[model samples]
Target: MSGVPTGSSGDLENKDILSYVALGDSFTEGMSDPYPDSDSVPNGRYRGWADRVAEHLADHVSEVRYANLAVRGRLIAQIRDEQVPRAVEMSPDLITLCAGGNDIIRPGSDPDKVVEIFESMIAELRSTGARVVIFTGFDTNWQPVMRHLRGKIATYNMHMRSVADRYGCDVVDVWSMRILDDQRAWNWDRLHLSSEGHRRLALRVCEVLDLPVDDDWNRPWPPPEPRGWRSARQEDLHWAREFLVPWIGRRLTGRSSGDGVSPKRPELQRCERYRPGD
Candidate 1:
């Protein structure tokens, strides 16, 4: 990927500007969210944690450039073979990496192999004169079937922290931020993230990058109250009579209700994070 020049010449006033490169998988690609607009674009092209981190940085810093080369479903080897070279060519001041989810999902994939690839990527990024490298861990809700994968994820995170410590890079603990001891946070699929999850993640990334903190990032945003239980019950019954009854009838008796009922993969609820004074 080519380096996108950022900040005006006037923005640089006797201070060295920092260039950033963000690399990783679907979470890094801002999957499951609409792309943020340009004035909102600062950290990277993708609007995940990286972009949010950039937004926070914009409050305190002026001269910063970023390149995002993350793609959905990319494994460690693919990143090692492809993304690392492009990132190195950019000569970034900081590199943030989020990977290893796909590896955990694939059968017969070894965690040690994933670690090796990540370490190689780190070494290559460090060669680019980047002062600091930030590595992120997988969210606990990566998959419901692979619940045991958490141990592997932990192993990889431990390796990442050790490698970062050895090479003087920073480690962001995203896993802990999203996966608490409680169950209020995960999305419907028990994978991916809820809006609250993303908000918390964005705030933590800002903290790890040493960027200015936003108080709105920490406040709780409650869901809107339903019209009323009676109204909701009526609405539910109407839906059952209007849609569900016909769909079930068609499925059970091989009859055509002409409703075109196709089950869709469960989507995470699109709840917006609470902003101050909203």
Candidate 2:
């Protein structure tokens, strides 16, 4: 439950990490955070934590080939059936997997069952001798409706830790990263991390990998602007109408935000670091 320390034995520091692949749901897909230099590009990509980590690795190594096989709204089963095999085939030097968030949040979902499938995916990925990385779901106890699901999330996180231990994998324990308790860390939808949140997570991942970083993941943010009850209620109403309602409707109809959406970067290609005003 403490902050992730630097220079741990689990670090992939000295490995010839020439290639990396990321796998999972919306969290791994990099939602709510648009690429910074995307003003000139229409429908620019969501550069999430995985991409940021890839960019950092690219800087340290010679031509770090990176691929992200994550799609938003994917279930654990979908990831196992769809993305896991492809990642194994690619045989990257490193792999990051963060699935099961969508499943644990769904109605009538069983954490045990979800983690069982997740463990299988981890087992297969480890078989390739790639250094595998996994993530724990964020603590949503402070959020509304989602707060009720925190129990399930915690259950899943516990199992994830045990599995990671058994599989010799690294973990970016999002649940223990208390700096993410701020509202500014979330996007308007409250489902995915904001740009700032993604940046912090990237730093955490780098720390786990024993990669060099210039910023602190635990750095404090500027003071938040205060809002009155009426203003807060109005914003909540707008969020429910614009995001919450549509999300629930899609679930009822068995539709997903990623119904036809493809992975942003499917092939193992060189990654460029994202810079402001580039």
Candidate 3:
């Protein structure tokens, strides 16, 4: 669908966007990425796609207020119950919602129920008359045990598309990127996206928002070196020990990696530029 034109939409001219709020889980919180220690980036803020998008918007647009309400390891329900209220109160001109990834990946998850809850959240956010941007969950085609959840992810993506249609919101189709299926796009955990992966996501979102961008994230990378079976098995064992085991234990104990974590950009303020030249 064509996006809303900035000219007659009354959303601030390209130079005067007031506020932009982002809401979601680890994907939005930018789990694997680190916040730079410079003045440009907030101390310990995850420079994830949401922040990346905000940086770009701030460069082209002026007085742009940005807030990231995302927290890592949050469920769709938690986002709806927790983040939705603040986002509604903020009532920014633009808002991004990228939840439900954590729910679809878990065992015994019901895609229909997840979609219902997600749609409800989107509906609530849309009521504020903000331009809501949503994302599809990528498939874990390269991961061994996680690949089985691909069908559930696909089901959730379909629901997201439907919600975007019903709510007149924008959808970033991350699931069909194909590049994300490659192991290189993932971090050591094999669940979260690497820094490069987040970069590509920022570009894709820029396209969805009808913003100018230099990189074409759809381009595939050069062929990777093939690993021997023994090496592959050893790497898999290490990943299971370091990431998978701990993730499972936390789930069993009802603990989350983001239990005490708060958002990096909790308030709507001027966003600093990130590598503007690039």
Q: In lDDT terms, which candidate is top?
A: 2
Estimate, for each residue in 141-244, the C-alpha lDDT of model 3 and write its tens digit: 76768778888888888888887887788888887788888788888888788888888899998888878888898888889998899998899999999988
Q: Write the per-residue lDDT of candidate 2 for residues 1-278, one digit (tens) a residue.
A: 12222212343445554788999988998887788766732253788899899988877876688999999899999999999999999988889999999899999999999999998898888887788889999999879869999899999999999988877888998999999999889998888899999999999999988899999999998888888999999999999999999999999999999888888888999787767732
lDDT by residue (1-278, candidate 1, tens digit) is: 12322211222123355565677765665543334443442233335565555444444555556566776656678767767787777766566777776776555777777877777776667665565545555545544445667777777788887767665566776666534323334443344454455556777766655555645454554654648889856866775676557645654675542123211111111223323321
Best by TM-score: 2
Window of ten residues with lowest summed lDDT in model 3: 1-10
TM-score of 2: 0.93
Clashing residue pairs found in predicted model 1: none
Clashes of 1: 0
**Residue 61 CA displacement from its true place in model 2, Å:** 0.8
Judged by lDDT against the true structure, how good is candidate 3? 0.82
Clashing pairs in 2: none
Span of ten consecutive residues with least summed lDDT in model 2 = 1-10
TM-score of 1: 0.65
Better of 1 and 2 by lDDT: 2
Candidate 1, which segments miss by more than 4 Å at Cα? 1-16, 36-46, 139-144, 178-189, 216-278
Worst ten-residue run, lDDT, model 1? 261-270
lDDT of each: 0.56, 0.86, 0.82
